[model samples]
Target: MSAFEHSSYPEVAKLTIPDVSVAALDMGCLPPVLKRFVEDGAMRMQAPVDFIVVAALCSVGAAIGTSIRVQPKAMDTRYQIVPTLWGAIIGDPSSMKSPSISFALNPIQSLEGEMRIGHKNAELEYKANKKIFDMKLKQVEA
Candidate 1:
């Protein structure tokens, strides 16, 4: 045995992390309508374009769950895969998570407001129609 081998010496170990390759953003992955919104949102919010786009997609997907789905292959057993998703952004206190998400989802909030107004109007109309039908039924029964 060599002197170094016979002597009491510490062993040094080398560790290596594999190189990972990530593809560039493909705008085609998003619908044509949303591509513009994502681009605009990223610019307006002064955040990473990819982050903004992904967050927007996640929010929209949750909002429209079960309404739309994907069938990847004809031979698949399931009818479709629901487009539901959940996403979270973790960062330090100054990361501005709330502002970024709020900026990205402002359009959704606006649509929700419009929908609430429409629902209120529809409810009032239904109540009025029910009252009229009740009166008509009472008259017929008299």
Candidate 2:
């Protein structure tokens, strides 16, 4: 009986294993704004943080456009940051992919709507003031 002793029972079929590796998500790499969105989205949807964070970052970056730029000390040139990015939230139909994205974009959408309303009100006020000034000018000329 050596160190590799075998049982007296019948031999069983050997199982073959596949070579596979899984990569993990690194939340620390995310910026503060995106990290917060990821946590909030995960809590609301009861889903993993990885997908939510990616989706949120993409949405925010696209909305921001080229407002911000990235410059590296090691690099000779400055990189004009067009933060627009495309991401995929892959899951089955039952997964709350759309809902999570919508949740992330809700704040931005609401702000845009409010800005549009404010612009309309300002235009109306400007037109009204111009009309009053024009009427006064005609009366004085008469």
TM-score of each: 0.69, 0.65
Q: RMSD in angstroms, candidate 2?
A: 14.3
Question: Candidate 2 on 30-112: residue-level lDDT in tens?
Answer: 88877877887889788777667767777777777788766654575665444458888877786778777777778778988
Model 2 segments more than 4 A misplaced = 1-22, 69-81, 136-142
As for candidate 1, its clashing pairs are none
Candidate 1 per-residue lDDT, tens place, 33-102, comes to 8888878877777766676676788878867878887898889968788766777776567666777788
| Each model's Cα RMSD | 9.9, 14.3
What does the lDDT read for residue 44 in candidate 1?
78
| Candidate 1: worst-modelled 10 consecutive residues by lDDT | 88-97
The alpha-carbon lDDT assigned to residue 123 of candidate 2 equals 100
Q: After superposition, how far is residue 62 of candidate 1 from its true place, in Å?
A: 2.9
Residue 53 miss distance in model 1 (angstroms): 1.6
